[model samples]
Every structure is written in C-alpha cells, then in structure tokens.
Target: MSKEDTSLRFRQFEADDAPVVYSFCLQLIFKQSCWQLRKKTMLNRGWMISAVTASVLLAIGLSWPVTLITSLLCTYLLIWISHTAYSYYLRHNRYQDLCSTAAFVARWCSGGQDRLFVATLEDGTVIASSGIVHQDIDTCELVRVATEESYQRKGVGRALMKYVLRQSTSFGYKTVVLKTSDVQTEAQRLYETSGFSLSKIYTVGRGIMTVYYYKLNLTDH
Candidate 1:
C-alpha cells in the first residue's frame, strides 16, 4: 500500500453522508446518461438519413448554397432532438426515480441487508463510497460506487471497493454483482482488475442504452 492509501480510513455510511452520496450518484448518472445519449444520436439512423437527403438534394442540381443551408438546418434539428431526448431521459429514468430524494437514498443505503461504506480522510471528509445490497440468499449486488472527482486516480476508489468486498464476505454472500453502463469504461476496467467478470449485457431506453452486469465469486477470491 502507498502512503496515501494508508492515510485513508474506511467506515460504514452515516446519516450525514446520505446527501453527499446522493449527490455523487446523481453526478455520475447525469454524466453517463449525457454521454450515452450523445453517442446514440450521432450513430443513429437520423444522422445517416440527414446525410442522404443532403446528397440527394445536391445530386438533383440544387445550388451549393441551398445544399449547405439545408445540411446546416438538419444539423441544428438533430442537436435539438438530442437535447430534448436527454431532458426526457433525465425526467423519467429509473436512476432519477431511485435517487429522487436524499431521504430515499439514505433509507435505501442503510435499510435491511443493504450496506454502504465510505472512505474518508483524517478529517472525516468522504472521498469515496460503495454499497452492497441483498440480491438473494447467496448473492449481493454492489451499487453506487463513486469517488470525488478531485480525489480520483488515487487509491480511494480501490480501497473502498476492497472494503465493500470484505463486508460482503463477512455477510456470507457467495457472489457479488454490479451493473455499470457502457459509458463507464474506467469503472469497467476497475471491476475487471478487481476480479469481476462480465456475466451479462442488456439494453434499456428503447435499446439506446447498454448496461453491463459483472459478477465476482467470493468463494474463489
């Protein structure tokens, strides 16, 4: 362990940490949702149709100025559509529903068999958090793993993950599972390095969003 890792401490989630954790979860969801929507818009058939229409107009002997203007208008329309879709997603997505209130998030994190862990500095500032929730008798789901942006690239996230896994084992879970979206490449890498294997892939939002499910068998670890 590095000196920075040694300076970090891990503890269970407290009531005061609810607001911070909820904010962190919201930030991550918003960022991932925006990226996913933007990428989908760029790759969707709408852009291809726009290009084909512009080409056909030019081929039909329209003036260069007209073709250019039409293409620019198409581009603006697509941008507006993307923005509208993102707004609608933010309003109706399940993530927003689950994180709708700090009180709800607090109850979810600490209720029943769910457990949330946080990594803090000596001064009690939470830099990272990870949660384990009951999935079944022998399985647990990992959720809401997040790190402060300024404190990322350090060992904070990894340490928090380790703590969560330890707690999962202590709770007699045989497997640990987590779901992350396709846009979270860094998080995917972290989970892979930590011994989680990709077990399933599914799409939501009318197939515009891709979600990956990863699992770690604690018995093998």
Candidate 2:
C-alpha cells in the first residue's frame, strides 16, 4: 500500500477507538457518582445528630463557667450517642441480610483453608465485607466472596462463599480462616449451614470473638 494510504488507515483505526475510551470515561463517572450519593446520604443522617449536639452545647454555654463545662461535656456525650445510633441505623437499614456475628465466623472457618481470597460485593457499596484479608494463626488470605445484605437469605452469601472456595482451590491454597463475633447468632447458624465449624474463641477489645477455621483438601481441588 502507498505510505499515505497506510497512514490514512491507521488514522481511521484510532478514530474508531474513541467510543471505547468514551465508554470507559462514562463508567468511571457513574462509579464516582454512586460514591458521592452514598456519602451525601450518610452526611444527611449525621447532620441532625451534629445540630442537636451543637444546640445542647450552645444552651449550656449560657450557664456559669463550671456548669457550662459540664453542659458541654454532656452535649458531647449526647453527640457521641447520636452518632452511634445513626451508624447502627445506617448499617441495619443498608445491610439487613448479612449474616450475624456467628455466621460470618463460621463461613470463615469453612473456607479458612485458603492462604488468600479477595472478598467484596460485586458493587462498591459495603467495604467491610467478605473480601477482607485475615491472617489466621498460620495463613494469610483474602475473603473474596460476599453478598449484598439486601439479598441475604436468598442464598447470596452461600453462593459467594462457594465461588470463593472454588477460586481458592484453583489458586492452590490449602486453607482459610475467619472470625465472627458471638453476638451474631444468626450468622453463626448460617456458617454452620455453609459447612463451617467453630474452632476457637478469642477476645477483641470488649467483644468475645469466635474463630472458625476451614481447610480445603487440595487433592480434591
């Protein structure tokens, strides 16, 4: 082909690539939009709590110095309570189906044979999810399987767990480990159903943690 014709063809190819680049840009923008919306929702929930706390502190500021200090302290305490309540409400509202403390631990034990698994939801809503990496007594692994809370009880977590286990087997890991707080009894039950068993009990901060360890036989992998 003539040099000019060849250069023209290359230019056409580059021009045709525009749509792919544009689509990627659009995808990135939508993802960012989702994150911003979630943040705004969280901030709105926090606003009322912050306003009430500020008002209480302002009211106390009118009193004598000692009383004012006491009032401010009380206001801060109230603010803290409000923040906690708001967070609980958000989680409860957002993730109703995620198994409770015990279930998560059980799943961990059942799948704890892999050295690593990536855990997370398909979408980017909940960050504190299965894709998290945990270091058991001997192995370090990723928890790549997780289901959205809204889809729990419908076999979402189970499916994700199974997928992760398979992936772990393919990845050539021998075992995986996980822990769930005993407070989550429902989660504990779920884990049992998923073939996980309780392995040990430990403590973190003020909460008693249940550790479930699961080993995948690589021969079957």
In terms of TM-score, the best-performing candidate is 1
Candidate 2 lDDT tens digits, 1-221: 12112111100112222233223323322233234433443444445554555567667664455555655565555545544564455335642222243333343334544222222333422311234244443343533333333444555455445555565455555565555544445556766666665666776423212344443343444
Error of 1 at 137 (Å): 0.8
Whole-model Cα lDDT of every candidate shown, in order: 0.78, 0.41
Error of 2 at 99 (Å): 22
lDDT of 1 by residue, 1-221 (tens): 34247779999888777777767766666665565666665576556756777898899998888987897678657756766666667546645534455654556654689877898888998878888879899999998788888787777888789888988999999999999877788899989999999999999766666889999999998
TM-score of 2: 0.38
The C-alpha TM-scores of every prediction are 0.79, 0.38
Clashes of each: 0, 30
C-alpha lDDT (0 to 100) for residue 131 of candidate 1: 83
Q: What is the lDDT, from 0 to 100, of the residue 78 in candidate 2?
A: 56
Stretches of candidate 2 exceeding 4 Å from the true structure: 1-129, 132-146, 206-221
Q: In model 2, state the lDDT of residue 202.
A: 72
Candidate 1 lands at a TM-score of 0.79
